[model samples]
Target: MAPPLDTRSPSGPAVSTLGRSVRQAGIEDIPAVARITQEGPLRTDLDPESAARSTRLLLTHIAFERGALWVEDGVDGRIARAVAVVPGGQHSPWETVGRVVAPDLARVPPGPDADQAFRTELAAVAPRWVLSEISQGSRARPGPPTLLEAALSWARAEPGWRHGPIAVVADTDAERKAAESLGFAERWTGGPPSPWWLGVDTDPVAPGQA
Candidate 1:
């Protein structure tokens, strides 16, 4: 069996300039994480009990792997958002979950120093792929695109890993187009249509004949 995950606070310089600190979340954060998700674009219909249970399960799993569950807080110290990074195994799929920025926090472009901090911080976790479900509407909200760019930049920096074919599963043409502009490509055309998977490969030149 694999070793237990590390749920300790991430050690390094902070990565966000919006006066928000990203840190490992504990059991106490379960409710806040669930509450944030309830307000997301992909809101779940699950009841409060179910949602809390699911959140706890995800947080526990991430804690076991030395991976991280990050909570971004506002200046007043209210939890504004959360992100969980799940380590990928050789045969496992990539999965990440989190909330969009909470309403009260300021959104700032990650500076060069901040980007470096992010790269170093993420490398410590070294996930095979990073995935998040960004709401289409969030693109216009303020700082998400910059964060996405920083993520893509990190993926590009690692040559050994195929960063993508990143896919954005969306339900509309406009959302699909927005993903395209950010470098994702269409990999297929069928779905229930409520959530279409729009994807692009990180190494467009990766070997193989498709």
Candidate 2:
């Protein structure tokens, strides 16, 4: 079994103004989180089963750390409408960006090997904050702004991370545009070992305002 969950509630005021239920993802939410990402704009480029397994491992890694995986409830309250992964730690986001984009990581079987791969890469990744992923479901309700609002709120409240750089990776032209509309600017283009575009925004909205 995974370690005990941090009972310290996720920092930041609730974002209910969006008329969506957004909260930190728990162990039980793992499956839905996996399914949403597989069906969303950011593809793992894997088959259904593989993608689910891989995403589970990744989510498990985040679930254990100070980082957070926030999910918005669908119209049917029980299902996840969208997910946003906000990374937090001392390591720089640039250090582990390559490993995060590796296609082979998605193929690792759901076992000790997969756990090790995820743990290793995740340990090296600590950013002031990274909107690591923003995936939507078919019936997605809340948009990126709501998700980002929660992230920015948490960052402002977290020690040693107030108002620092926020990074986001874009996997398509549409995603790139969305990031731009949200105030992110292109920071890097893809190269070997990294297949996605990187965008950075130094100024994001504060808590309760977005």
Clashes of each: 12, 0
Local distance difference test, each candidate: 0.42, 0.51
Question: Residue 14: error of model 2 in Å?
Answer: 4.3
Candidate 1: Cα lDDT at 53? 62
Worst 10 residues of 2 by lDDT: 95-104
**Alpha carbon lDDT at 99, candidate 1:** 17
Q: What digit string (tens of lDDT, one per residue) describes model 2 on residues 102-145?
A: 22233322345434443444443334666654444122332455
TM-score for all predictions? 0.48, 0.59
The root-mean-square deviation over C-alpha atoms between each candidate and the true structure, in angstroms, is 12.1, 7.6
Q: The CA-based lDDT of model 1 is what? A: 0.42
